[model samples]
Target: MQQSEALCPKFEFAFSILSRKWTGLIIQTLLPGPKRFREIADMIPNMSDRMLSERLKELEGEGIVMRTVYPDIPVRIEYALTEKGKSLESVMREVQKWAQQWVDC
Candidate 1:
């Protein structure tokens, strides 16, 4: 019998981000385009504002999400995928396809 090698560091790192609660959904939500914080909260039902805020910060730190602040009567903010984040579109789509086919929930 052959022993399996340890997971690649890059793969491990990627999973570390993806495996976080609400991370993938947040990424998916932003895939189409930029959105305000409230928009994201609405799209992903049941995710608390605090959790979403934390996850967005994590993603921003990861260079996956870019947060933009607009100056206006009320300072508006929006979150969008960076080029690095946009790169995950194919991966996310593939996961969605798999989930549709095999995920029971």
Candidate 2:
């Protein structure tokens, strides 16, 4: 089946991913650089490891994120944005700008 079709019959694309509580945050985190699984987990301290892993898997399956495995002593895996994921950067930036107007750091 097609992508939209896969998400259909129940949860649509928006509700399936973007509408999730921490999904947007995870996308934002990947904007900076490729991050390891632990890095994403650390960045999103409130989100459980299982939840993060699930989200990553979901995103990967959606063709938004790329999972890279390094050949080394142990093995290091990292997650980075695919072209589709990077396309959301503009949307994220706009959201950031809007939030900054109210939320102060």
Candidate 3:
């Protein structure tokens, strides 16, 4: 590791979180608006219900995602981004732009 990377632990920390599997995708999915658990799952192809649930919990714990529960027959739940999470929108957009330029699909 470079000396600068070692010195700037915050960058490393942020990169670690964003680099995790599905973290970026989850954030991207929530960028539009709040959504039900199933809605998120359906948006991301090949995402398991279990993995989605786990990532949501982790994001919630980090204050990046907000989970709301409504009282109903079976129970209704929705997940949305908090202010902190919304702050990442620009970053996500930049990534998307970069991917478009450099990655061939």
Alpha carbon lDDT of each predicted model:
0.94, 0.89, 0.93
Per-residue lDDT of candidate 1, residues 35-103 (tens digit): 999999999998999999999999999999999999976999999999999999998999999999999
Better of 1 and 2 by TM-score: 1
Say what the RMSD of model 2 is: 6.2
Q: Per-residue CA lDDT of candidate 2, range 1-105, in tens?
A: 778655454446555668877899999999998999999999989999999999999999999899999997699899999999999899899889999998888
Q: What TM-score quantifies how close candidate 1 is to the native fold?
A: 0.92
Question: How close is every model to the real structure, measured as TM-score?
Answer: 0.92, 0.82, 0.91
Off-target runs (Cα >4 Å) in candidate 2 are: 1-16, 103-105
The TM-score-based order of candidates, best leading, equals 1, 3, 2
Model 2 weakest lDDT span, ten residues long:
5-14
Name model 3 segments beyond 4 Å from true.
1-7
In candidate 1, what residue range of length 10 has the lowest lDDT sum? 1-10
Q: Whose TM-score is higher: candidate 2's or candidate 3's?
A: 3
Note each model's CA RMSD in angstroms: 1.9, 6.2, 2.1
